[model samples]
Target: MKKTVKLTVNGTTYERDVEPRTLLVHFLRDELGLTGTHIGCDTSQCGACTVSVNGQSLKSCTAFAVQLQGAEVMTIEGLAKEGELHPIQQGFWEMHGLQCGYCTPGMIMQSVQLLDRNPNPTEEEIRRGIEGNLCRCTGYQNIVKSIQWAAQHKNQGQTEIPEASAPKVDPQPIAPVP
Candidate 1:
């Protein structure tokens, strides 16, 4: 039987009919075209399919689409704003956190959730938080650095800003240069 379900994903809402047995990962990747979440291991041991559901890190592959009728889901695609990259993504890039890039999206999603719970996680906490996420490349040294960078970066947000932001082009078109 097909079940009608609503999904609030990445600040957007969508309602559709789906099979009760449809996994959340399938719904996200296939239905919504969110291919950022991957299915590395079908057994759910790998965290490659990780996503934030109602602010909690979960294995998307193991979750049923119908189970998330009213939950707010955050995926890798939701982290960045407009054209700017999220701090975690910046950290990953600056710190060289990825090697193969196959596990990056999941790693980033997990890191965001981890930092949310413990904004100042220690090295051990960082390790434990990402234990479920296995990366065949980089050996996790750079990944830890990336998370640490994000933790500190988030902590810095607590302070007040002087001008709010740097100067940038406005949404409206600029006068054509002569």
Candidate 2:
């Protein structure tokens, strides 16, 4: 049976019918079309599906949509405002915090909570804060720089960074060798 779940996401209220077993990650991606939250490991180890629930960082895969009937959820899409990137997001962009970009959304969301609790976290503290999130690329050095950038620039408003244009490549058939 599909149960109706009403919740606020990214400052918008939405009510949808969902199966009892539907994970919040699936609900966000499949139902709501919020695909920024990636699914790495469903076993709750990757932390790729992290989201903010009621002001706390949560792994969306660990909870059912129905369990959070009236919760306030914030996904990566909510990090920007008025067409400007949030401090953490700006940090990631400027500091090259991501390589594959699969783990970025969760990392940013988790960092939100970390900075909330400790605005000026030490390098070790930042490392401990994001221990739950795993990144296969970048060796975590740049990710740490990203978070540190946010910590330093949290109070300043950042303009949106324009997306870099990708170089166009045209494939040409190889000449036959005689």
Global lDDT of each model? 0.85, 0.89
TM-score versus the correct structure, for each prediction: 0.87, 0.87
- Which pairs clash in model 1? none
lDDT of 1: 0.85
**Per-residue lDDT of candidate 2, residues 51-139 (tens digit):** 99999999999999999999999999999988888989888877788999999999999999999999999988999999999999878
lDDT of each residue in 22-46, candidate 1, tens digit only: 9999999999999999989888888
Question: Lowest-scoring 10 consecutive residues by lDDT in candidate 2?
Answer: 165-174
* Model 2 regions more than 4 Å off: 156-178
